[model samples]
Target chain A: MIKANKIEKTYSKTAILTPVLNDITLSIQKGEYVAIMGTSGSGKSTLMYILGCLDKPTKGELELDGVDVYGMDDDALSALRNKKIGFVFQQFFLLERTTALDNVLLPLIYANKYPDDALQRGRKVLAQVGLEDRVEYLANELSGGQQQRVAIARALINDPDVIFADEPTGNLDSQSTAEILDILGHLHQEGRTIIIVTHDRTVANHAQRILELKDGRIAEIKNP
Target chain B: MTRTIRIARESVRMMGRNKFRVFIMMLGIAVGVASLTLMMCVSKGAYERVMDTVNRQGPDLLQIRPGTDIQTGLPSGSREVVSLIEEDVSAILQHVGNIRAAAPVKDRKEIEVIYEDKFTLTRIFGVIPVWAQIRDFGPREGEFISEEDISFAARMCLIGQTVKKNLFGDLEPIGRTIRINNVPFTIKGELQWKGISSAGRDRDNRIVIPITTYTRRLFRDMHLTQIVITVEDTKKLNKTIKDVRTVLRDQHKITSGEPDDFAMRTPQDLIDLAYGTSRSLINLLTGIAAVSLLVAGIVIMNVMLASIAARKSEIGIRRAVGARKNDILKQFLIEGLIVSLFGGLMGMFLGMGGSVILSSLDVTASKITPLAIAAAILTCGLIAVVFGIFPAKKAANQNPIDTLKV
Candidate 1:
């Protein structure tokens, strides 16, 4: 679960400031499926990054599982990202020359648990994502759909409590996008908390709740 | 099983993959080691050649000549008619603890040694029978004159190979009649050729006769020219020389304030001085070689820095995946160490081979001390680590996000 209150972020030394996220507060409980939807430059990705502990908010009270994430050091933030959160990128960001299994094992490198069991868990996650036969294949050799599944397997490698996906199917075709949506739906049914950042209405429609951002602030919250 | 080992293996594999670079690096080290080894071999060979020529005279052998005063630029009045009689030689033999043997020698120049119609002007040496053993003189034919020959003043002479060639030619000189200074004497033995001394004096061009015959019959009651003393052991040569000087001064009744009439020398002293000079020369050559090795280390460091720069993306990926700073540092350091280790091994093989080849070619064989090899390896290893630090630190300190951006 992630909680942020009055979050603000800015870049550069310009007095004419462009805020990526401004005075916005939100909290997501465990086992909830939520979507943040916005057009380009509307700050949805920035909000997702802050929520994932990848970037610190300029001014905010942010907590994850009752621990003050905003007050944590860089190593602690990395640890939180490793143990408590998983990220699935839109572009599938798989290491280009490495096998799908190796790409999936990347997240567990930071995990404190037994790495052998984590590798076994990664294989299981790949099987769950319908990439069991393609685990040994490289990212460039796999179809776009399969690469996204490998990224999903990588995000699930550490068995994180929450999965944050940013435009998870933006680069996929209709068939591949449908498969990714079905995988997300299955994960939500398994009682895993999920937050997706996207511009597509069809992708947001699958979520239990949707938050729309406009010009660095949350415009509206719609319960599905 | 450790991650560090895995990283080291990976680094070695990478070095192997870049064969040309590794070869260039190794070439640098090899050239340095080879030059060092060769220099040491040649210098040591020349030194030993000189030493062998000197030692062939005898162990504990010393040549005492009158010393010249440096400030006056003239021969010092240090040469005294020390008058080394047979009794003096006996006293040194009996009283000096470390003296193995002693003999008094008188060199008579421009002496005509004639046998049949053949005649030659040669240097004649009047010496005791122990002089043959002390000077390592071996007879090619017949036998050396005995002590009884010297006591009875028998006119028996040992002719050197050159003397036999000039005075007797193709005929055997043993028992042949020879005239020294027109005085009749029988040739008792023929000395084998001993080439030349390091001082460029021909050792094979002299005739030796009994000291009693030369002192009484040739140079009547003359002062002895030189006293040759051979010590029992080289380690105690200085002590023996000191004791001999003390006894001679006491016999001559020289007061404590005046300089003694005799001079003493030791073969070990000459050997030590020669070896010391040679060692310094070897060290100088090795020091120059070390500079080149240091330059090679710098080259390796530069190449490693380039490698780190080129592999920035790969490093970024590893760091992003939770590799600690020390892990990255270790990886780069291992790469440097692998390069240097390979270079060091190749250099050792090449250096030893070169030394063998040089020795086979009649050059003085090089002594490859374990200390030298250990020093070379340790220096290479240390250079690798020292030069690797900056590049490794650079690689380790890279920000993953900035690196991943491009």
Candidate 2:
């Protein structure tokens, strides 16, 4: 459901030429679980950002669901991000002062669909993530595992086709990390396409396909 | 929910969190509005007080005196000496459609009024009986001289409260005789107290007698010094004055180009002029107060900008959660509005209280009007919005990624 051809991203200034992503080409079909694995400074995050429509590529053609995302304006790109993709961050990035229910309802605010059932849907997602009793608790009051569960609940609130998990288990304990991996596997089995960006081999092993990044280019793609 | 309302509510909540800052902000605006209200009340009250005094004297009473030339600042042309005689007064009353009543007046020098041993120097006024009604002075005891007394030239007089106090010394002066300039005159009545006039003349320290008796016995044809006329209605006073002036000019036979021998005045004219001056003074004072309110609003804007900077991460989170740029702008604008609203309310109350206290202490205070309150609130709202724009724009323009980075 997503495609990129010769995507290039660069930063300006200074005599030395520096590129964050150079001539990267990739594509992923619907319901495919993919992992982009890279160490620091390997352009994995930049690629993830481009795919998420959060930033524009310096030079490229990007198509999502037959729409040229690269040609979309800022508002259209934001709308695409809201409707087509859900993001889960390493820090769980839930609003600190807001309750778990409200955190999950955030994406629905932009979607403007099923607004009357937003609270009910958020509650259902929280229950699915095993956070039924912590729906009203603030994000800061939750443990790393519980916070990540809330993030996952938020990702599922809009029932988006693709979910982006960037270093999702980076800050969690091993047991919490395993639980999050199991949830990702379940989501994948449910026919939701999932992309996880991480450096951990165990995390990458949960994906159906793994793409490794070296410097600013994709080194290899391995079918797990 | 509507974006502005949501932002206003959030702004209120934020203000609630920072109690001390809100308190300081309100203090500045309250002081400005309160002082402005107080000054307006005092000036209005003083103007009304003066106007009331003028009205009580007579509605169409004109004091034609020697005019001081603007170029030289001196009495012009030998004082003109165009006395208001009984014939002139009668002519105005007969010819002027709106002239309800008119009377001639003359006064004697300070004379000794004695009842047995109690005595005092008092002004003895030579006035026609109709003058009493025109001047708003009614008898507190018995009655003023009648037309019969005027025709018969009776030796009777109406004494003022001060004269009664000095001559009778707690005893009723009616039906008793008082010596005025060594002439024994029966005290027909005691005049009611009428307070002081705008010209600072005492209205309760004079004795009144029929003009016929004064002209025949006290001062003969001293050119009937003044004419006091009461118009039928206050609204038609200008027309009455014009008619009276025309009659006077016809009687005196002064040609169109010649300076006339009379002047006309109305209580409404004096009242309006005094009110205008008072209103201008109030506007000036209010303008100064509004400047202070603007300064206070600016202070609020500066403080809110600093707060926006400090809460950058909070803003980023809100924005990431679907808050539009307009929402952020509304939040800060609402904050300013909240501060100004509370401040304006408090100031209004403070102003009212101040006016009441001042009036109680015998200071003149203006009557409070709904228009004034509405104006005060509107001014405060405008101040909030005008000063709030800069801070709100600054907060709205912050980039979510950059703000969230730290």
Candidate 3:
């Protein structure tokens, strides 16, 4: 469901160009649970961002679910993201002042065909993540583990096919990290393709396949 | 729900979070709209006042008072020279065209009048019987000063309603004798109720006597105070005034270089004089309203720009959640529009309250009309749209990736 052909990303300053991702090529099938692992400067986050359709590569082609991603305009690109992809960040990235239910329902705002039962759908997702009682709690008022759970619910709101978890447990305690991995594992079992980016080996072992990056290139690929 | 209302609800929630910023925005627009409302109120009130004066004095009536230097257009005070007389009245009537009727009048205030044991200080007007026709007033009881009264110089008088109330109480005043300046004169008529004059004085507080009797018996002066003339063609007053001026100048033998020894006045002149100060005041308010709105618009722009800059994270998050650039634009624009609309209403109420107090104090007159309300709202809308664009555009153009990374 996801493919990249020779993807390259570079940052150009006044007179210097620094490469962030170089000659990246990969593919993942439907319902696949994959993990990209790297150290701080290994460009694993950059690769995940590219795969998540949040950024365009300077030189490459990307296809998500048979659609040429970069060829579309900004509006179409945004619509594609809302319909087919969900992102869970290290910071959780929930709107700070709003309730967990409001954050869970965020993706539906841009869904084009807003469901008549959008609130009910949001509540169902929150309940799926063991947050039925925390739905009315504000994001700032939630614990780190609970905030991550709310974000996971937000990702599931639009029922997207591809889920990207970039350092999803980076800021959480060990218990919260385990909770997030379990939720991602459940989503994968439900036929959603799951991609996790992390620097830790323990987290990578949870994925069915692991791709390790070094100096902006794929150095090793192994099945766990 | 419609897109506008949805965006407005979100915008309102955002604005409600910052109380002081919203207040500052509201204050500027409120002051500007308040001044705009006040300007309209005063102008409308002043116009109505001038028309009232014109209606009361009779549109076709003009007066020639014994004054030469009436540079201010007032027919009294130090400019009066007492050079006009009964003969000049005849000359102008016979010579000036468009003469409907003419009457000579001499008046004196603060005369002690006695009726039995009751006495009051009253004003006395010495006028011919034709004064009744010229002034469009006549006694409701008894008779006006007649031709015989003018020819014989009889000591006959007409008492006004105020005089009757003061001296006679419920007693009948017609045919009763009253002592004016120690001279006994029979009250031949009781005048009708004329209400209050435009000058804020009681109109029915004086007595009218024959001009012949007034000149010989009471005033002891051959010179008349004024000649009241009603023109046949109301539209031809200017030309008639010019003709009368020429006749007076020729009869008095005043050279072209010398100013005439009499002053002319018309209802139109009174209207013009009444508006002189009010027109300038209205213009000053217009300038204030314009400048206030301009400054307020600029302030709104600067505040909005600063707010958009500070709200970068919020903008990015909204964009990330599927909001289009145009959606952000609509949101902020709706926010400013709501603020301005409320500010305008607040200002309107404040202005109305202010006008009521000012009018009650007998200062400048003011009335809030429908046009004033419409103008206030329209101006607020225009200012909001004009000043709200840059900030909304900046907000819409914010990059979700860059902001989210921070």
Model number with the top TM-score = 3
lDDT of 1 by residue, B1-406 (tens): 3566656655665576577877776776666655555555656565665577557756688544333122221113343444445566667767779777777887766678777787798888888888877888867888887989989999998888888778767887788788888899988889988876544557788998888899878767465666787777888877877788777767667799987555555565455544554566566667877787777777877877887777776675555444556767887888777767778777766776776786686444465556556766776788778887888999888765445433
TM-score of each: 0.68, 0.75, 0.82
Please tell me how candidate 3 rates in CAPRI terms.
acceptable
Residue B404's lDDT in candidate 1: 43
lDDT of 2 by residue, B1-406 (tens): 5445545666776676677878877877777777666666666676666667565655566543223222221112342454556678778767878767777877754667777887788777787787777777878889988998899888899988877766777787799987777777898898998766454556678988887787776656566556677777768766766777788889888789887665544565556544554566566667877777777777777777877887786665455444566767787778878888898889878887877887787644466666557767887788778877888888877765546553
DockQ of each: 0.17, 0.19, 0.34
For B1-406, candidate 3 gives per-residue lDDT tens digits of 5545566767887888776887888888999898888888888888988887777778888888876655455326542367877888899888989999998888888799998899898889999877888887789899999999989999999998999999999999888899999999999899988887655567798999998898889878777778899999988988998998999888888998998888888887778867776788789888998999898888888888888877776776666556778888998999889889998898888777777876787777788899989999999999899998888888888766666664
The Cα local distance difference test for each model comes to 0.75, 0.76, 0.85
Better of 1 and 2 by DockQ: 2
TM-score of 1: 0.68
By lDDT, is 1 or 3 better? 3
In candidate 3, residue A135 scores what lDDT?
85
In candidate 2, what are the lDDT values of residues A119-218, reduced to their tens digit?
Answer: 8888999998899999999888999999999999988887888898889999999999999999999999999999999999889988989999887888
Candidate 1, A1-224: lDDT as tens digits? 77889999886558777788889899888999999999977888878878887777889899898888888876676667777777787767776667899788875554544365756787899999998888789788999989999988888877788898989898999999999999999999999999999999889999999999988888656875
Model 1 residue B118 lDDT score? 78
**Regions of model 2 farther than 4 Å from truth:** A4-28, A31-63, A66-84, A88-156, A164-224, B1-60, B66-101, B108-111, B151-153, B198-202, B215-225, B231-269, B272-285, B326-340, B389-399
Best lDDT among the predictions, by candidate number:
3
lDDT of 3: 0.85
Query: Which residue runs does candidate 1 get wrong by more than 4 Å?
Result: A2-224, B13-59, B69-100, B107-124, B136-142, B159-187, B190-207, B212-226, B232-265, B272-281, B361-364
